[model samples]
Target: MNLFNPSKRVRNLYIKYGENPFVLLSKFIYAAHRQKWSKEEIERVISAAKKGNYIALIRILRSHTHIEE
Candidate 1:
């Protein structure tokens, strides 16, 4: 995923969900859980997300799930 230039789906998700890191982090965690991600993987993503970078977090989410456009 492009961290600097977000895709259409990512943009839509960002707009729909807003830029709140906490909210996005929850969604990411949910997606990760739905995908049956390993605990370590989930924790790593959570760790990365704690930095509170919107684009980076969205990229991580996009990597794990399909964000329909």
Candidate 2:
């Protein structure tokens, strides 16, 4: 789950679904699982998604690249 790596699933999903909130949120959830994010972090992303904050969701996903063990 190296965040720096580009995920084929994500790319394929984007190709098929475009940049809709549901797709972005799904990507966030998937990345969060792979990255093993903290409960609070996952909650925050979920909250943003629930609120229809696509930008926030993208930001949160981007931030995942900086997460370290």
Candidate 3:
């Protein structure tokens, strides 16, 4: 997983906000809602995000945005 190859939107958010975990987590939840991701998937991603796993964050965001789930 290339750090720069996942969700461009999320990467941009990180670049813009300097990787605030809470803010990114909030955005991930909001985006999951908007993207209609499953509750389980959202919860899983949220859990991972809350743990401060950037790789999980990127994977989940890419999965949501790119329909990889």
* C-alpha RMSD by candidate, in order: 6.1, 8.1, 7.2
lDDT of 3: 0.52
- Candidate 3: worst 10 consecutive residues by lDDT? 7-16
* Reference-based lDDT, each prediction: 0.55, 0.51, 0.52
Best by lDDT: 1
Off by over 4 Å in 3: 1-17, 52-69
- Quick one: ranking by lDDT, best first? 1, 3, 2
TM-score for every candidate vs. truth? 0.52, 0.45, 0.49
Which pairs of residues collide in model 1? none
Across 1-69, the per-residue lDDT of candidate 2 in tens digits comes to 222345312222232234776776666667656756566766664674466355555654554434333
Model 1 agreement with the true structure over 1-69: per-residue lDDT tens digits: 422224212222332335677776776666656666666777765776556567766656565445455
Off by over 4 Å in 2: 1-18, 52-69
TM-score sort, best first: 1, 3, 2
Q: Which numbered prediction scores highest in TM-score against the true structure? A: 1
Selected candidate, larger TM-score, 1 vs 3: 1
